[model samples]
Target: MFSLATWNVNSVRMRLEHLLRWLKLRAPNVVCLQETKATDQEFPYTEINEAGYYVVHAGGKGRNGVAILSDKEPREVTIGFPDVDDQEAKERIIAATIEGVRVLSIYIPNGGSVGSDYFLYKLEFIYRLREYLDSYFDPDQDLLALCGDFNVAPEKIDVYDPELLAGHICFHERERTAIKLLKEWGLVDTYRALHPDEKGAFTWWDYQFGAFKANRGMRLDHIWVSRKLAQKLKKAIIDREPRGWKKPSDHAPVIAYFEL
Candidate 1:
């Protein structure tokens, strides 16, 4: 049984304790973290080492960072899109091979509003991710898992109130379509594939207005597995305990188990 988890920590420096505690409790073999918001110089390498995981990270000083942690040392670590010099996306993506599996930590941008520049960039980023996969890997043969805070809710069932949130930034049809195209590239949404009809199984909630208490959230975080890895998938879940913890990030951790 190999367990892998993905979470948007919001800020690694601010939520270090929570991460340490969760790591001890859950004991996942590999972890992919997004929104670490710490540059290489400021990353808590020593502390993470003490916690018993080898980590590789990329990011800026204040925003859009991604990291992967494994109990064993990771190899073939890659940062940003391969063969593409995308500065804005530099810190938002990271990948490494751990225990014979290629895992990616991605922090997809949250578009501010419809038809905005950021929104367009968000769409472009998703397409570029597909291209990246096409150029580097074959989903039919590779043992790959892509995990992160995707920022887009792929289906109506993923949100608490579909009618109310319709056309919202994360729940928009365009965003859903983009995610669909990505999935068509030979990836499976692990949780949805397992719990096909589950509703309101969200991973992110607003930090305001008691959204977490009310369970008014969106399933923005995901663990997408390639076809070969998907065949080994035994379980997938959204662990909401961390979100209820004091000083928690708005996003919860998503965990997947495989009979590897």
Candidate 2:
């Protein structure tokens, strides 16, 4: 079984110690990260490589960034959605082929509000993702894994209280629909597929207002797999322990195993 994981580390630099500790514990074959909040030169790739992984990143100044750290070398490493023309907006995507499986580490924009420009941008970004996947990948045949913070909860059960959070950024209709369309295109949420009846199985919580303590959270981070890869799925898990650690990221790591 090969193991892989995704995490939105908030800021890789600040959380490097925690991340290194976690890596030592889990030691997944491939790890994808989002919200690294560091430029390429500042990503601490040397430290990561010393930890037994080769790291690749697409990043800049003080915001969104994505990275891939793999025990095996990655080929065809790409930094952003090819079709999206905006080159300076934010670093949100990184992808490569590891052991024949296409691994995409993406940080989908967090829609600021229900009816805001940022919200529309988020939707368009997701749509662009769909377009990219359709153009380059065969979801039914290719062994593809999209692992990162998707920012949208694809189902009512994915949120603690869908009614209370109705039309909210991550729970909005359009956002959910975007994930719906992606799944329809032949990808499946690996966690949901395995734990169909599980509820309140969240991956993120607000650091404010004791949200994590109250168990008020949303399953924003995810590991989405193509049909062919899903068939090889062995296990999917959200490691919540990291969220309670010192200077945590407010998001947990989601790991999946497959008989690759």
Among all candidates shown, the one with the greatest TM-score: 1
For model 1, how does the per-residue alpha-carbon lDDT over 1-260 read when each residue is reduced to its tens digit? 99999999999999999999999999999999999989988899999889999999998966889999999999999999988898868899999999899999999999899889999999999999999888888999999999999999998899999999899899888988998999898999999999999987999999999999999999999999999999999999899999999999999999999998
lDDT (Cα, tens digit) per residue for candidate 2, span 1-260: 89989999999999999999999999999999999999888899988999999998989776698999999999998878775677643488889999999999999899897789989989988888888899999988899999999999898899989999998899999999987887787898999989998998999999999999998999999999999999999999999999999889999999999999
Clashes of each: 0, 0
Worst 10 residues of 1 by lDDT: 57-66
Candidate 2 off by > 4 Å: 88-90
Off by over 4 Å in 1: none
* Model 2's TM-score against the true structure: 0.98
